[model samples]
Target chain A: MEIFSNLADGFAVALTAQHLLLALLGCFLGTLMGALPGLGPANGVAILIPIAFTLGLGPVASLILLTSVYYGAMYGGRISSILLNIPGDEPAMMTCLDGHPMALHGKAGEALAISGIASFIGSFFATWGLVLIAPQLVKVALLFGPAEYFALFTMAFATLGGVTASNQAKSAFAAALGLGIAMIGSDSQTGSERFTFGHIHLYDGIDFLIAIVGLFAISEVLIFIEHHQGGAAAKSSAKIGKLIPDFCIFKRSIGTLVRSTIIGFLSGVLPGAGASLGSFLSYSVEKNTLDRENKTFGKGDPRGVIAPECGNNAAAGGALVPMLSLGVPGSGTTAVLLAVLLQLNITPGPLLFRNNPDIVWGLIAALFIANFMLLALNLPMVGLFTRVLLIPTRILMPVVAMISFVGIYGLTGSTFDVMLMVGFGFGGWLLRKLGVPLVPVILGILLGNEMEVNLRRALQISDGDWSIMVGSPLAIGIWAIAIAGFVLPIFFGKKVKNQMHADHSEVEMEEVIEGGD
Target chain B: MSDRIFGFFGLALSAFYFWATSIIPDSFMIDVVGPRAFPYIVGTVLAICALYILLRPDAEPDWPNLMNFIEIVFATAVMFLYAWTLSKVGFVIATVFATSYLTWRLGSKPLGSLITGIATSAGIYVVFHLILGLSLAKGPLGF
Candidate 1:
């Protein structure tokens, strides 16, 4: 009854004219942005955060708009994957395996319809799961003390190491660098500036917006220059023939869609396992189970197209569970959303349900609305999205750069932040060239403050004794999970590496997509 | 740079970070693990990872050629200049010049790039200023 009333109240808030308009705009822009060759959902959301803040949409409206963009990007990503043989982001790599072949076979319309339907079903199920499970999850999350929180953060980093980056040492170094960067502003506990180097702008500890713009947008521009000058790749001329999949086809794939959604959602709820992992895992599972004879697994099998699309979109919804309930983002885009929340001074956690139910539940309702909007919007607009690719890189890149600059400056009203953004862009490019993952760096910066605060709080409660961190059973359990997270990666590193090598482009796609956010 | 050189650089950065952490004086207000502790712990762990990377560096990936490197450097310098001049020259003027030059470099004709630059500048100004009620920097022209 409480959930029902809360949801009804949420619907009241989300269904408002202003919120609905922003949600539509976000969805439209997100699909357009995500359909771009290199821009991922993270980049789309990160670039727009400053706009959200500057527009003064209030917290709930801003969140509704941004989360809509996040969902919109997931829907948009498959368009390019199926048509152009280019995955819009890492998760869409699975879609490309069969989506392109289906396109080549002149079943582009069927593929698009099936994937759209799958994405819809996936997000629909996952959203319901979020509404049902998040309250229960929050109840458990509320019991966590400072020690448990710290341990959970540590576990997040460990899991991130396993799933995101191949080189554990490099990931650790990147995370440490982010933590070091976060420590620059005046200490929260004390008033001492640790590493400002006497610069006034450093007082606020590097505006995260600046870092995000510099890291993702600027680095992306540099890469854009490299590729654009080399002469752009040929645009796809694939034509859509039909508007919907056959009834028989849809009936045959219902079970696959449901199973993949479950897998994707479960993977998403687990910290650090992202949409890509979920999509790939679902694809593999479907291949083994449904296509035991391997008839049409990757050869334009409609199930192949449907399975991963469902998993990835579902995983997007799933990723919100940890972020909304635990304040721990499960993926790069979610991390950006978390940053947006923190910027709005809305700390996500169990308290969020009690204090800011409008923002939380409004966002949930927006997700439901956004998914439906995307499904409606994507079906007839396949040609429209394809036309987005026709915009020359020259025109598009400059607009992207200008928006980033204006957006960053508009938020801070500071040129130094802009300059810092440039510096970070250079650093991001250098890091990318060196094969260091940027997501972990961003995650480290995002989590560093909370991690330190919790650790100190735990120590403070224990009278400066660190043993209190492991004294509780919950803390002990989390620590064990963290330990397993750390060591199990090492043991399975070789197998993971070999699998990655088998699909090297997936790794490259991950690297490229990092710059989008 | 090769992985070996990168590893050495990482080692050097970690050492400097450790030195930097050492200089953060202990805080008096909060006694139980003050601000320095977190930085110290991060510094120590970073140093260990730096050493590990230094000792066991992976094979190097392919580096871009000098032309591509120069393009990247030039693009970065252009952005830095745009940032410097954004306030002084104001948003429209700075963005027009910067964006036009970027578009030109990326393969647009000079006239087309200029049109793109002007159109984008006008569009951004209209959206951010006129509609959104967020005032961007205005030069003497005062849009």
Candidate 2:
């Protein structure tokens, strides 16, 4: 009864005309960004951060808008995968296994509709799961002390190698680099400058928005430039025969939708296991469980498309649980969201629900509305989004560049910060070329100060005793998990990486053969 | 291999970072753990990771050809120039130059690039400055 009343109050806040408009705008923009091949949720949210600030939207409205984009991007990622044999993002990679085949068979519209419906089912229930789980997780987070919190951050960093990065050593190095960047400003504790290098602008440290936009959006443009020769445009000439799927296919996929949703939701809830893992795991599980003979999996099976689509969307919803409750992001996009919350001076954690109940409940309520909006919007709008794929990179990249420069300048009014953003962009490009994952770096920047503060606090409490780090059982357990999270990845990570590569090549090979024919 | 080169670069960075941390002036009201402690740990971890990378380098990476490399550098230079001249030339003028060059470099015809540049700058100005009421840098001609 209390939960229902809370949700009702939340719905009241979310139903305002302004908030509803923002949600609608976010879903639309998010889908457009998601349909684009390279601009996934993180870059989409990052590029829009300054606009949100300039609009002076309240914390609740800003969050509602951004999170809607997050969910919508997850929904839109399937468009390119089904029609063009190219994934809109990494999580959509699995969709190509069967989605392209469906397109080839003139079921492009059916595939899109089915994926949209499955995504709706997955995200709808997962939002409910977030509603049920986040508050309880907050209760548990309430018990954490400084030492335990420090250990928890370490656990977050340790697990980054498992799911995101290709190499653990490189991931650790990127994290260290991010922490080093965080140390450039005046010390929060002592007001003493650490690495300002005699520059006044360095005193305030690098802004998170500048860093994120630089690393994601700016570097993306640079990459587009370098790879411009090949012109990776989608040429989807497949006829979309029907807008709706056959009833029997939907009936057959009912069990698959439920099973994949559960798998994906759990994957998202786990630290560092994001939508990519969710999609991969759900698709593989469905394939192995149903098609052990491997006859129907990569050969245009509806279940194959349904499984990954459902899983990734569910995982996208599930990723919000840890971020809302514990203040640790569940994925790269959520990390950007966490930065937005911090920028608004609203720290998300156990105290958030108590202190900012309206923002919290309103966001959750808006998520429900956004889900319905996406389901309604995506089905009719598939044709429009497929057209988004046709825009040339020559035009798109310049606009992206203009947005980054203009947005950064607008936010700070400092050409100096703009230059600093460009510097970060170059560094991000270099690191990316070296095969270092950028997410860990962003995570490190976001969480480094907090991690350091917790450690210092714990040490201060114990009178400079290092043993206090392991004094609590909870801390000990978390450290153990951190170690396991780091080490287990080294042993098992190669298999997963190889499998992904294999899948990628298989899809590319099929494309090559199709092109030759 | 590229990894080994990156590893060496990381080592140098970590050494410099550690040296910088050591030279941070001690604050009068510093606690038992100073600001240098966390940075020191970060530098140390970086060194270890870099050392591991140096010892076990990955295979040689696929480097872009010379022309592509030069083009990337040119794009970076254009961005840097745009940032440097943003205030002096104003958002509109500076954006027009940068957007035009970038679009042309990305394979647009000169006329097309010019049109895109003008259109993009005008569009952003209308939306961001006029509608949103955000302040933009004005050139000598002023708004």
Candidate 3:
């Protein structure tokens, strides 16, 4: 009953004309960003962060806009998968398996409609799950002391590789690099300069936004330039026959949608498991259970298309739970969102719910509204979005570059930050070539200061005793989970990554054969 | 192998970071854990990770061909120059040149690139500066 009343209040805030408009715009822009290859939700939100700030949107409005983008991107990721056989993002990889096949069969519109519906269902239920579960998680989080927080942050880093990273060493190295970057500027507690190197700008440290825009946006431009591949424009030859799927197709996928939503939502709640794992797990599980003997699972199977789409979107919603409740981002995009929250001076965690109920509830309500908007917007606008795929990389990359420069300059009015951003961009490009993951680096930067502060606080409480980290059973349990999360991935991660690649190549091979015919 | 080179680079970075951490003067009001303590831990962890990479190298990564590599360098140089000149030459002028060059390199015709560059610069100026009322870098010719 209290939850209902709180939600009603949230609706009151979210229904305001300004917030609603922001949500609509966010969804529109997010879909556009997601339709383009190499610009996933992370980069989409990253690019818009400056704009949100420049507009001076209040905390709730800004969150509503960005989270709408996050959800919209998840919905939009399926467009390229169906049309071009290229996933707009990692989580959409599974969608490409069945989606492109459907597209090849001239059921492209149907595939797009089904995916949009699935994404809506996944997000809708997952947001409810977030509403129910986050408060309980916050109850658990309320028991945490400095030591527990340190342990939790450590666990986040350890598991950030999830089941995707091919090499944990590279992930660890990236995390350390991010922490190194975080160590720049004057020490907050002591006010002593650590890595400023006598530069005045260095005193304030590298803004995480600059690092994010640099690593995700600028590095992307460099990669585009290096590939020199003409824009990944949609093939005019591919046909989209119908806008609506048959009722039977929807009925057939209902079970898969429910199961995938559950799997994705749970995967999202787990720190660092995120949408990629959710999609992978949901797709694999559905295949093993429902399509074990079908022989048509990947041959334009609607269920195959539905499973991963629902799973990833649900996971996207699920990622928000831990972020809002525990101050631990569940995915890369959520990590970037955490940076946004920190920039707004609104630290997320248990207290965020207590201190800023309006923000938390308003954001939750806006997510609900945004999901409906995305479904309505996406279904009618599939052709519009597919047209986005036709946008050439040649024209798009320069716009991206200009936005980064102008946006960053507008935010801090600092030319030095712009220069520093370019440096990070180059460094990020080099790191990517070396097979280092960027998400953990971003996470490390976001969590580094908090992790250090907690550790120092814990030590201070225990009079510099190291044993206090595992003093409580809760802390010990968290540490054990952290250790397990780090070690277990090494054994199983390779198999999962290999399986994904194998499936990818298999699909590509099939496409080539079909093209030949 | 590239992995080995990356490992050595990481090791050097960690060593330098550690030395830098060591040189931080202790603050008078420092707590039980000083500002340098966390950095020291981070540096040590980085050193260990670098050592692990060095000891167990992965398969060699695919390197870009020389021509592709040169193109990448050129693009990077253009970016650095754009950053350098952004404040000096103003956002509109700098953006026009940067976007034009980048678009051209990305395979657009020169005229198309120039049009794209100009259109993008003006479009952004109107949206961000004029409409949104956000301040941007100004040139000698002002608006």
Candidate 4:
């Protein structure tokens, strides 16, 4: 009765004409931005946040708009991955393994249909899971103190294997580098400046948006330029014929769809394990199980496409649980979401549910509506979505660059931030060239300050006793998981590596590899 | 090898960071762990990673050829120049020049590239300044 009553109240707020329109717009823009090769949901949300802020949409409506973009981007990412062999974002990388092959075989329509259906199913189930589990999770999260929070953060860092480049050491280095970057501003606890170098701007710290734009958007521009030789245009012959699947394809992939949704949702709930990881894990599990002997995974198998597409959408839904319930963002896009919430002076955590039921339930209800909106937008408009790929890289890249400049400049209103963005752009390009992964760096920067703050808080509470780091069973369990997270990758690294290699080779000759960088 | 170069660079970065950490002014009221301790641990970890990278390189580094390397350097310079001049010249002028130059360098026709630069600058300026009600940098013309 409580859940039903809450759902009714949520619908009362979410189903308003104004809220419905915002959700629709968010979904449409999310898909468009997510379909862009270099700029994914993070960019989509980041660029739009300032606009939303300026629009003065109340907190709920703006969130509805932004979250729809997040969901829309996940669905949109599959379009490029399936049709052009270019993943729109990292999670979509796995979708390319089989999705493109299906496209190449002239079954692009079926592939898109199957993926669309799978995304709907995954997100549908995951949203229900969120509705059921988040309240309980928040209750548990309420029991967490600084010591337990420190342990949880450690667990989060330990599970950061999916973001690694070649080896664990490289990933660790990238993370540490990010942590060091996060330490640039004045210390929150001690009130002493850490690494400001006497500049007044440094006191507030490196803006996350500046770092994100530089690392993702500008570095992408630099890479695009470096690789762009004259007369090399993006060529794709994949056409959308029909947007519906027959019963046979549906029946065969039903199990995979269900299994992958569960895997993806669970993975998304983990602190730092994002949608990409969920996609990778689901694909691997399906590949290792259903097609074990001969491994028909990357050879245009519909299940291959279904598994990751479903998993990633589910994971996107799953990722929202932590951010809503505990105030800990599970991924980059969620981090941006958290930033927006903080900017609005709305602290997202357990207390938020009791204090602000309207916002919380409205968000939950809006997500349900957004899923259907995305399905409607994606299915009927498959042909229109494919048209976005025809835009040339030269034209697309410059637009993205200008947008990055304007977005950052608009947010901070400081040209110094623009320059800082350019500097980070160069740094990002160089780091990518040297084979260092950027995700860990971003995560490190995002979480570093929070981790230190919690750690210091725990230590101070215990009067310098280090044992407080694992003082409770929850802390002990988290540390144990963290250790396991560190160890499991070593044992199963080779299998995952081989599967990734297989995915890379299945496409038509690798022309210009861009995603998963 | 590129790894070695990166490894050494990482080492240098760690050393500089450690030195920087040493100079952070300690608060009079000492806590369990000072502000400098986290950076020191990070520096140490970074140094170890760097040392490992230097000692045992993973993959053979693929350095870009002469032309590509030159293009990269030139591009970096253009970006830096754009950043330096943005506030002084304002958004429209800086964006037009940087984007047009980059577009041209990417092999667009000169005239088309210039048009693109002007179009992009004008389009963004209108959206941010007029539509969004946000103030971009005011140059001499103030538009």
The per-model lDDT (C-alpha) reads: 0.84, 0.88, 0.89, 0.83
* lDDT of model number 1: 0.84
The numbered model that scores best in TM-score is 3
Please provide TM-scores computed only on chain A for all of the candidate models, following their numbering: 0.95, 0.97, 0.98, 0.90
Tens digit of per-residue lDDT, candidate 4, span B22-122: 99998766688889877888899899989888888878756677897788778878888887777778879988998898888888999999998999889
Q: Report i-RMS for every model.
A: 1.8, 1.4, 1.0, 1.9
- Candidate 3 CAPRI grade: high
Residues A1-517 of candidate 2 have per-residue lDDT tens digits of 6777889989999999999999999999999888888899999999988889877888899999999999999999999899988788889999989888888888899999989998999999999999999989999999999999999998888886655456799888888988888888889988889898778998988888899999999999888888883243665444677887787887887889889999999999998798999999999999889999978888788888899999999999899999989998867888999988988989889999889888889999999999999998999878888887878889988899889887788889898999888888888888888888888789888888889999999999999999999998989999998888888878888888789778767867877898799
Ranking by lDDT: 3, 2, 1, 4
DockQ, 0 to 1 scale, candidate 1: 0.70
Task: Report the C-alpha lDDT of model 1 over A160-194, residue by residue, as the tens digit.
Answer: 75553567888778888888888888888887778
Query: In model 3, where do residues sit more than 4 Å from their true spots?
Result: none
Better of 2 and 4 by DockQ: 2
lDDT tens string, model 4, A1-517?
A: 6877888899899999999999999998899878878778887887777667755689999889989999999999999998878899888999998998788778889899889989999999999989998999989989999888877765655666643224667877888998899999889887898788899999999977688778877888888788874332246545677778775977887789889999999989986578987998899899888998845777789999999999999999999998888777767788778767765778777889989999989999999999999999988887877787777777778877877777777678787898898888889888888778776687678778888888888888999998998799988888898788766776776676676666676554433342333
Per candidate, native contacts kept equal: 0.75, 0.75, 0.80, 0.62
Find the candidate with the highest lDDT and give its number.
3
Indicate whether candidate 1 or candidate 4 has the larger DockQ.
Answer: 1
Candidate 1 C-alpha error for residue B21, in Å = 2.0
TM-score for each candidate, following the candidate numbering: 0.96, 0.98, 0.99, 0.91
How far off is residue B94 in model 3, in Å?
0.6
A best-first ranking of the candidates according to their DockQ comes to 3, 2, 1, 4
Our tally of clashes for model 3 stands at 1
Residue-level error in angstroms, candidate 2, position A115: 0.2
The global Cα lDDT (0 to 1) of model 4 is 0.83
Q: List ranges where model 2 is wrong by over 4 Å.
A: A229-232, A236-238, A511-517
